[model samples]
Target: MASRAPGEPDYQRLAFRYEPMAGRGERRPVIVVGAGPVGLAAAIDLARQGVPVLLIDDDDKLSQGSRAICFAKRTLEIFDRLGCGQRMVEKGVTWNRGKVFVRDEEVYAFDLLPEGGHRRPAFVNLQQYYVEGFLLDCALALPAIDIRWRHRLTGISQDENGVTIEVETPEGTQSLACDWLIAADGARSATRKALGLVSSGRTFRDRFLIADVRMEADFPAERWFWFDPPFHPNRSVLLHQQPDQVWRVDFQLGWEADPIEEQKPEKVMPRLRALLGEAAEFELEWVSVYTFSCLRLDRFRHGRVLFAGDSAHGVSPFGARGANSGIQDAENLAWKLGLVVKGLAPETLLDSYDAERVEAADENILASTRSTDFITPKSEASRDFRDAALDLARDCPFARRLVNSGRLSVPSTYRTSPLTTADRDAFAGPLEPGAPVPDAPIRIGGREGWFLDEVGGAFTLIVFAGQGALPDTDALRPDPLPLDRIVVTPPGQDGDPPLHARAVEDREGLLARRFDAAPGTVYLLRPDQHVCARWRSFDAAAVAAALQRAAGGEIGRC
Candidate 1:
């Protein structure tokens, strides 16, 4: 059965109940404040790792409009780990290539995922409500998660041990305590406000109108962006296809445009008719005007209260960076917080979440800021530069690289992360320490699968073997921490049985070529599927030491 209709969602207000134990001062393990995609994803990730979580949200309904309609490949892969990727990809509109135009003329085209062997597409256009609904279903099914709707966080304070929060429930105000508090409440975070922390960054003066229209159209399943089109004279426009005969259209209205007036049907219809032609027939499903800013807190962790998603940072919607990066924040924070809460790693391990994610947030901010400036030129000189670049891009290949129709979102690389053990072996291609591992095709036990499927949820050692016995992992795994292994053999190797680690035959040599692998080449991956360390040959001692360092233990080298 479908969750909601194609045009707009029927808002469902979930019931609210008072849990006596929450206010009775019994300390809980983890409490996540917010039920958006980021909060739900965080709660689910922690729960899957055997950590009980209490997820609270101030409101009872899913997000209203088609806000955040784009989900990137990295975000989908993270969803796969959360056990909801298949449903999302099956329901959302998938696309990989997009075209750019200048004054109704095509300037250049780009392909985000030009190569194959990946599980999910480069981008999926689904409404934020659908994303939230799917994630909520996942959270409810996990026995470790307790979701409380209409539980607003009114006050928060933290000490060296844990955080104490005051929540406003249906019955009355209540007090709760937890070992850690995750604030995913969104851009205007009550938790951040209560703590007196501020996010510092720049805010653009331009505005954009989002019109979700329901119509039968022939637009291809691809991103089509225009700079100074004929219909909308000097301004930019963006078009995207969503599931269920709905389309998302974005028109750039200048800073002086009145937000209320622009959202009216009379004002919006003229613009739509101009683009779709006067003869077209359609119904306006949803309409809104928005102004965005790029900002983030100086530190994601304040005492025992941690922040993720919009509560921690926010960016312009141009690049689809806000939600994608926020979900990633949950991924980065979950494993570290899980280890810290379980006492398997020291509390200091949580600090790396700040160090690594802050680096990523800063990178995203820089990219988003640049895209905004290019799309909306602040000065005549800037517009001239952009126009010239667009004109030259039609012919010169080098100028095409300069044309920025909002450089689409991609996963951030944590090259400066403190948890990464610097590369000691010479390597080629882009799979380096602190980089997210790329996926390839493989066959294991007479079944085909992707490379990433065999390498998540724990610290993993991927050993590239060549038609030989599977490498023994007896000495590689350390005490109290389970390390998984995937032994990749040559393409034609037959499946073997009774091995300590799972073995896969590189079905097309894609895995070998992607990882720059050779006989006995070893890669050490963190729980979040990031490469922490690698070597030309499998050295049990080096891999063990690197694994320990990645878990926030003392840094060791071999």
Candidate 2:
């Protein structure tokens, strides 16, 4: 279902009401709160792992916000793993570059997470409503999914065994119990607030007014940031393209201007005209004025109750990292939860979820806050220096590289995570197995083609072409050493590497391209396409170990 924008809060009924549970209801394994991208993603991931999921939303209706519009490639890869990649790529706009300007002149432009030696999943521009709807559809298709709408959570209590939640429903107040709980609520997350988690960081003094407008501007569909606006000398304007033939424009409103008062079309339309020329004809789709802060939870997990998405960290929306990072938190948590619940991995694995993801979350917050400082500096001298750099970087590639690298949202790696398990028997050196493995060209045995990613091979297997070398397995695993279980292909394969999917290697004998491992190295990739284990040389022992590991598991290996 398509949702209306943030302004049309015709969303019926107050946010909370009282309800009561009178009878004994069945308990679920996992109960997820919030139906937004982060919550929904966690629910869907759990459901896919064969864990029953109960998804709760404050209001029954789909959200209406231009809330999260841009998804980085790593995110797209996760969607692909969930069977929605092609649809997203096909339905959304693909962008490669973005530009920065000062006084109407181009100053800095750069790549968004430069291609990691392969055709990466492109950064897509689609409304948050559409993304959620798509994910909701996927969740419904799963046999174990239960999405509860109009369910407002008022309180929570947890014991070692499970958790109980107090929710106000349309009917009355009630309590729901589950083995695990994930609060994906928002920055003002009731869950985080309830836990009394200490969040650090000050809210920005300057508020940003964002509007989805229809205008005949000649600007390219890529992201455009301004160092200093020509109209508002003290503030800046940000322009980004969106679907539905509309664009999103943001202006700093000096913290004191009221959003409700600014809703007057007469006042808002003229400001939009300030960005696009006066001749540009446009209509407003939605307008919002919100403030952001660089706050983070003192802890992501407190006992059995866990926090995901904005419930965990809140980043300034400069690089479009907030929502994407939250969704990733869901991905990492859901899989580990599945393992622990199924008795596949130890509870120790769960501890790593908070430790690893919090690092990633902190990085996201730091990156976003830095981006915010670059575009909307708080100090007067900093603002002046920022403008001068923009003015001079117009023709300087060196300066452009410096500015552009920061804007591109690169895939966050887990090199420092405690959960990023590296084993010498299965892995060599300091390779982070849980990291998104770089793309490699390889040969498959079945078809008469040389291209990789055949059958959507992003997180699939890689086969060595000739001599059929045995690849030792068990190198890359995040934690608890599943042995054979992982979404990434292990280095060993039963049959000869399919010629169609073999990585083309250089003769001097190193991989010249991204996947260029030495000859006879069969690599297995994870769902996020990270290299798990690779075979320096494959043999019967390596192949047998992989098969043995695959057979002994609650999680199926395909």
Which model scores highest in TM-score? 1
Provide the lDDT at 277 for model 1. 93
Q: For model 2, how does the per-residue alpha-carbon lDDT over 1-558 read when each residue is reduced to its tens digit?
A: 133455433322223332233332778788898988888888887877788888888875555766688888777767766767666677676787787776677776666656444344447887787787777778879878777777888888888888888888777778888888999998778777666676787677777888888655567778877656686566677778776566888887877888777767887888887777688778888888888898888777777888888888888888777888887888778877876677766555566577768888778878877777766677988667666666567776666544521344556676654433243344444344556654433323433221224422223445444443334333433234333221212233224333323333322212223444444555554434455445655544544444233222312332
Please list the C-alpha lDDT of all candidates, in the order they appear.
0.87, 0.65
Candidate 2: Cα lDDT at 80: 66
As a TM-score, model 1 comes out at 0.96
Candidate 1: which stretches are off by over 4 Å? 1-23, 467-470, 495-499, 555-558
RMSD of every prediction: 2.4, 6.5
User: Per-residue lDDT of 120-221 in model 1, one digit per residue for the tens?
Assistant: 899999988889988988998999998888888999888888888998977888888999999999999999998989998888889999999988899999
Question: Where does candidate 1 clash, by residue pair?
Answer: none
Provide the TM-score for each candidate, comma-separated. 0.96, 0.81
